[model samples]
Target: MSGDFDTIRDASSSDEVQLVRLLEEKIKSLQIEIENLRKELNYYKAEMEKMLSPPLIEAVVLDVLPDGRVLVRSSSGPNLVVNVASHIDQKLIKPGVSVALNQRGSTILEVLPQKEDPIVKTMEIVEKPNVTYSEIGGLEEQIKELREVVELPLKKPEIFREIGVEPPKGVLLYGPPGTGKTMLAKAVATESNAVFIHVVASEFAQKFVGEGARIVRELFEMAKRKAPSIIFIDEIDAIGAKRIDIGTSGEREIQRTLMQLLAELDGFNPLDNVKIIAATNRIDILDPALLRPGRFDRIIEVPLPDFRGRTEIFNIYLKKMKIEDNINLELLSQLSEGFSGADIKNVCVEAAYMAIRDGRNKVTMKDLVDAITKINVKRNNMESMKERREKYS
Candidate 1:
């Protein structure tokens, strides 16, 4: 009876061990199942959130309503009255502030930071040019006026205030090509150490309607933000041409761009330290309004340099060049009448090239004469072609 009892006790112990092992296995399986369920729940939650999200659109604030709503011009081609989100501060909902709008509800989701317009950003001069006042020659009077008009206003505004006279708002540098109008602007920019933005008028005239005007707005806004800046518009005639009673959509868009530019020049917001310099070869074609006293206070004509001016230009270009001692600049200046400062520089460059081609160390008087003769021949050929075209037309 004792032996039977021992065998039964051992069997009972073994069965208890097996039961415990089974229970452990069941708990482990349940934990894994619970983890998988949580993962599935998370995945469903993400999908639900995606479905709940709405598309956001970009818009520019036009005006603020008295009742606390805002007027926005959507990028999608319509002006809208959108509700500002309750969480957003009302102060940042002012006109001109960019905002993100919910497409479904037509509400401003968030006030967006003003982004730098890519076009205007490219227009600004990132690195100031390596040009200075000394480098510019034969435009002493022009440089003087530019300093007083652009530099003084930014550097010493008190002088104008003390004299009880308002400084010029803008300067126009009109001239034939290569007379150094653009170079003068560069000198002023370097001397004043101000932000220089150089943009061509053709670029300002966008093909799309209202696009050009928008660029003008952003341009002036940027200039204002970067105070004590210079805005040089080369070839102003492209957009500033006289307005016509009737024209194509493209022409109308350019006129619109010009109107925006005029508005900016004579706008209510006074240009404190910002100065404008516009250059054009065809000043006659420009609108009369653009040349007005208030808009462009100084209409400086950078005409062809005189003989003395030519001499100065020659000296400026020849100073650094290695030439024979027999090189008489005054004679060269006299021989090269009607040649622009740029032409004179080109002559010097051509002389250098001739010497290099001949395996010579220094530019000789013959080299200078050869370059001048070569350029004169080219000019004569161009003039003959132009005359033939005119005669044919």
Candidate 2:
């Protein structure tokens, strides 16, 4: 009886071990299937996202095919399709040849401020001259110097090579507040007949991260591609401020923009045509790297005009104004000492008021004298002038 009980016990123990081994194998197989399902689900989810949300239509360009099939690239990577009813026919822009992408379920567009208008781009490239050299008076030396540097690249590139003097890459017009630095830059654009891109520091700060740097690169590229172009950055200190601590995300972005601008400017070798002209009232506040040899190397001082320069400026402005025979511009130039060209323009405008009050057709010396005196005296005395303007209103 004891031997029989031992055999039964051994059989039971072997059966229990076999059952446990089967259960372990089942669990391992289940885990492998679960992992494979998870990978398959992830891949399906990615495909779904792509179908739901697509990239923005970056650009719309017209492409004429060899077989005469007018095609358009929407830049969104969609198959080209056209709506015959929505197209226009024009010489510059042909429609029917036009196609657009349907932006559906896009999250990227939501991040941007507003939808950009395609029509505005056409207006931007239109060339128009604002102020010509003939419009500016005085500072003949400065104008002549700038003309040679700016115009030679366009008018006579061969002469420039023979002279062995590469046209200046950039010109820095630095001076006291209200000097003719801005005027000088405009004149360069007019005389050279180049595309002008005007940028101020205020505009730089307003741009979003990476946007400013992108604009800088694009503008430089544009200037290079459209050789014989001038890029004028006014009050450069605002954009080119010193690189301080990159403690904040904003600061880091600004640094990135500045570094990109520096790189673009450095890498740009004009096909011997484009030039950069920057102006700053506070040169001391600019970054050291910007003032180095290749960038803004020729720092021209636009000091307060001397007596002769002032006299010439007076004559130019007076040419258009209705002036009496007795208005003696030379005397007015001498009297308006320590004044900027802008200040002189203001004086001329103010003198016109006096002529109007006197019921005269032209301005006179007495009118200017009174205008000068009115400008210098404390504003407390201008109550009558203020009252007159208000009364008229």
Candidate 3:
């Protein structure tokens, strides 16, 4: 009996110890869970506080008073006298500086750093174009001129400085549509290793008043910030057309945009390392102020490819295609008179399509001829329709 009682007591004592250890582990687990929940609760509280805060308004300091008061022009409301926060930097509270205002817009909260306008940010081209000079078959002289005017100034500025001449600020490429004007700009972007900003001139002609001019200003400011940059404005005639006093709001707005462009071109702010390239199909309609000596500096005309140029272009386009030995590129070039580089490329593409349709493995001379014939017929029909429309209108 005594031995059995002792065994039972020992078993009960061991079970009590195990139970105590299990309870302690449970308490530790609960404590850890409480800590995590507290952390989550704090995060939620912080988020709620942020959500409840009033939104601040952007304002510009028009003038600074000797006292703590400032003349601020709120972005949404009229000018008002506001008091600057005591902790805000007084130096940055000067005129023309941006600042955040309180919910009431009666107190300056903090000075804001100047930011690149959103319009300019959208116009920046982050990727370099894949076009190279070798891919451009025609316009050797124009390419050479471009190199001397653009590449030389950028790659070897010492030559220009040594010769005691200011490097050219911009280049103007005028040609018919699809004649490789934009491609040349792309080649420049590829070659110079510069920040290329491609913007269509029409984009600057906004419907709202003052927006167009603002965009132009911001664009130039951005180009300045990203120095050693290239600004390629395609279809420049849209904004650079000759100004007229017709009194229409649209015309007036375009004139304002043009004025801003002129100012940016030769304004008090020097272009320095920034270069401009503009393309247009209608050079005659462009404003003379934009084409004048210092603004464009070099105006190279990109004409249609001549016979030799056409032959070279054909060879370039044909390089990737399997062709018969009897294919006469020279004859095709002769037949494609007045065809632009783009037109030749189209002809080649159409020829390949023809071969595929005929279940042929290679583009033959017959396919090439057929493609040229079909394209010419289509062009003639379009021209006839245009003539009829013009005559009737």
Candidate 4:
């Protein structure tokens, strides 16, 4: 009977131990469920806050008031005196600084960094162009002069310093359309080992007041910051046109941009390591001020290639194509009289396409001749249409 009593107590203790273990597991599961619920609640609260808040708009801080307010120009509305957020650094709220506005445009919620104009930012060439000096066929003389003016100073500044003379500030490349002016500039960019910032002159003529001048200033600032750089302005005749007494707002604006450009060419902050290259097809109408010695220093004319030049260009293009031995480049060059380098390249490409279409592995002389004829007929038709349009207009 005593032994039976001891077994009963032992079983009771085992049952009690099992009950404690289950209770402990229930407490752990409840804690895990509570944590998951807390995360879900927080997520929904954040979403609700985001949906309830008004959107912020971009603004420019025109001035900072002594009373701790800011004079801001909101993107959509007129300028107004707005309150600044207490958490923002007061020193950052200065004139011309960008800022963010609250929904009502009456409060500055954030201090923003000055934004670079997207148009100006994209003008910078981050990657070096693939073109090299050897690849360009014609314009040997022009290339030589360009190298002396632009590349020599960057590569061997000591030469210019020892001579006690300032290096050339800018070079002007003028020629007819379809010439190799722009291509030559790209090759220079590749050889110079410097930053290339290319811009079209017409882009400087902005619609708003003083906007063009601002862009000109910013462009030079960027060039100066990126030392040992090259600024290539294509078709510069658009903004560098001869200044007249037209007295119109648009004309005045263009003149202002031109004046700004002139100042940058010979500015107070010396361009120690920067070079400027400009190209134009209409140099005849450019202002005399822009062509002066200090501004353009050297004026290189890229003329139509001669017969020998045409032959060299043809050889260069043919080397890249699967051309047959029967194709006489000299003869092709003779037939392509008055053709620019671009026109010659077009003919070569057209010939290659023709060969491919006819199920041929190599371009033939007959294919090249047909291509030339097609180009000539098309050119004549375009000229005729242009003449008719001019006459009727």
Candidate 5:
């Protein structure tokens, strides 16, 4: 009976030891799981904080109040009296500097560095155009005038200063479509070696209110920063149209943009090294304000190429073409009456296409004539369609 009792005690002791080891292992696993759960909880907490934070809005510093308060004008909202955060430097808070505001737009979160507006950055032309003065034909006088007005001012600033005159503020190129106005602007941009910013007047007609005017302001400001810059506004009539009281929101937006543009053109802020070149097909409809002296110093007309001009244009376009011996450029020029330089180039291109379609290596007079006929037919059809639309309307 004593041995039996001792054996039972030993068995109980072994079972108890095994149970204790199992419980230790279980506790270790539970501790590891708890640590993993804690790490996951920390990650979720950070994510929630970020999600709950409010977005910052842009604002401009209007004035610094005497009692640690700031007068800031929100870009998308009205003016507000705000308090600057402690982290931001006090010295940097001044008028005209842009700042970031809190969600309610009542607290100045931080002061932002003066940087080029995104719209201005996108409009900058980094690559020089391949078109040069030589490639342009029959606009010798126009090109010469442009050089004097646009290029000369940039190339030789002292000449103007010595002559006791401000260099021309801007040049306006107005003419029919496809008459090389844009090409002339390109040549000027290439020759002057100034930063070129090309923007369509219609681009300023934004859908949102105040956006158009803002863009215009930013555009000119950018030009001022990047001094020795050329701003080419194509289709000027879009924004330069005469303003009227009876109008839609779109029209109001356009008028606002035009007002901003006029202010920039002849504003109190002298456009020191900046120059403007505007092109339009409809000069008659331009506002009287825009046509005045101080804004656009010179308004040059780019007309259709005449007989002699057409001949020169033909030679220029045909210089590289593989032509048959009998193809008379003079006759082609005489035949291309009322054709613009752009039209003549298209004729040359169409003639080459004709030759290619015929599986030939050279262009002939017949091919040229056919191309001209095709272009004329297309032009007539376009005219008839336009007339019909007008008649019906």
Candidate 6:
């Protein structure tokens, strides 16, 4: 019995030794595999980092936009923008060109290729009809005031500068609806040789999400680029109105856009040659900040046309139409008291229509009177009045 027990123990000990050796070999193989995997992973990680960290090369502009933005192509067959200043001298740019980029990894246009024929863009200036001081009568006082704000800015920059003053950052034209505030803005831009960016405040009031804010920023930046620019916002009361505590989401967004505009104007250096002029029938609703001294520094009343202004406006429109000798502009102007510039224009159009319907070649006083009566009736219509009131109120 002792011999059998000893033999069994010996056999068991040998089997245990063999099993331990096998397990050790398996562990070693697993370690080898893990080490190999680790090496491969490290290699892949290094390759990925190298690909992502490749240096970006500066590219030269192949072309530019009308706004003077550069469009360039990258070596990787992707298009990119070079950070060349819009004011960079055009003579410096040539095709197959290369430029050193600023530290921002943006390229500056440097070399131009001789073989490349680049596209040259020319700007065409369309002149709006002149609204001379003579064209606007009876508002000599208002015209004189506007001339100081509009005409003097360009005419007397040196005098203004010597006094350590810049032109008004903004001007608000407000009064009865259709009083030619918009027309005046156009005329101001025309007279000043300034670029004009026209926007309606209501457009900002209904924008999608962050678009309004982005558009506002872009507009200011664009205005900066186009220095001596006029940014005219019509219906200014819609977006510039003072905010209330119970604001809707849309209203809040509009307020944010307006606040951004205010900030941009506040930070603006008047030397940049940008001015803001807004027109609204209701200035009472605009934010007080918009009317502050350095911002909307000047508030001009574009009131209903007075008798003489109306007469001049009448002649201006009448001169364009076939009118009978019997048509008296003085009488028409006197009769259209409390009418706006737009109202006068419409009356002329309506009178012409009446004359045409009557198979007449020239518009006469009877046609004018009939048109005026119809216009009055339409103005007195409850629905139309309600709409106008809602618009301005």
Best by TM-score: 1
Query: Which of the predicted structures, 1 or 6, would earn the higher TM-score when compared with the native?
Result: 1
**Per-prediction TM-score:** 0.74, 0.63, 0.70, 0.70, 0.72, 0.68
lDDT of 2 by residue, 1-393 (tens): 999999999899999999999999999999999999999999999999988875545333233345433344455565453322223332222311223334541211211222333321222331444777776666777888887777667677788778666666778888876668888887777777877767675466564554667667556645554556677878777677786667987767677767877886676553356678888887887888887776667777788877887777778788889887787878988887777787677778888988898788898888887776766563435557879898999
Decide which is better by TM-score, 5 or 6: 5
Error of 3 at 224 (Å): 2.6
State the lDDT at 15 in candidate 5: 100
- Per-candidate alpha-carbon RMSD to the true structure: 6.8, 18.7, 8.5, 9.9, 6.7, 15.7
Q: After superposition, how far is residue 45 of candidate 4 from its true place, in Å?
A: 27
Clashes of each: 0, 0, 0, 0, 0, 4
| TM-score of model number 2 | 0.63
Model 2 bad stretches (over 4 Å): 1-126, 207-210, 244-246, 377-393
Local accuracy of candidate 6 as per-residue lDDT tens digits, 73-126 = 554556766666555676565433555444455656344332221110111122
Better candidate by lDDT, 2 or 5: 5
Tell how far residue 287 is off in model 1, in angstroms.
1.1
lDDT of residue 288 for candidate 4 = 90
Model 1 TM-score on a 0 to 1 scale = 0.74
Question: In model 3, which regions exceed 4 Å deviation?
Answer: 1-118, 121-126, 206-210, 268-271, 385-393
Residues 241-320 of candidate 1 have per-residue lDDT tens digits of 88666378788888888889988898622227778899999988888999787797688989899889988888888889
Point out where model 6 deviates above 4 Å. Answer: 1-138, 382-384, 387-393
Q: Write the per-residue lDDT of candidate 3 for residues 1-393, one digit (tens) a residue.
A: 999999999999999999999999999999999999999999999999999999999987666677769987788979889998888877666555779999988888888888867666677474566788999987799888878788778777778778778766879999988789888887877787767789988877753456888888777766655556788999899988886664988888889888888887885222266789999998999888987767886899999999998999999999889988899999999898888898888899999999898899799988888888888887788789989999999
lDDT of 5 by residue, 1-393 (tens): 999999999999999999999999999999999999999999999999999998898987756789989987788878899999999999888766789999988788888888766665667463455568998888999999988888888888878878877766888999989999988888887888777778887766743356888888877766654557788899889999786663687887788888898987876222256789999998998988998888876899999998888888888888889998897877888888988888889999999999999999999999999998888888789889989999999
Pairs clashing within candidate 2: none
Clashing residue pairs, backbone N/CA/C < 3 A, model 3: none
| Per-residue lDDT of candidate 4, residues 183-288 (tens digit) | 8888887798777888887767753456788788777656655657788899899889896584998888888888999988976222367788999998999999
Clashing pairs in 1: none
Name the lDDT value of residue 203 in candidate 5: 68
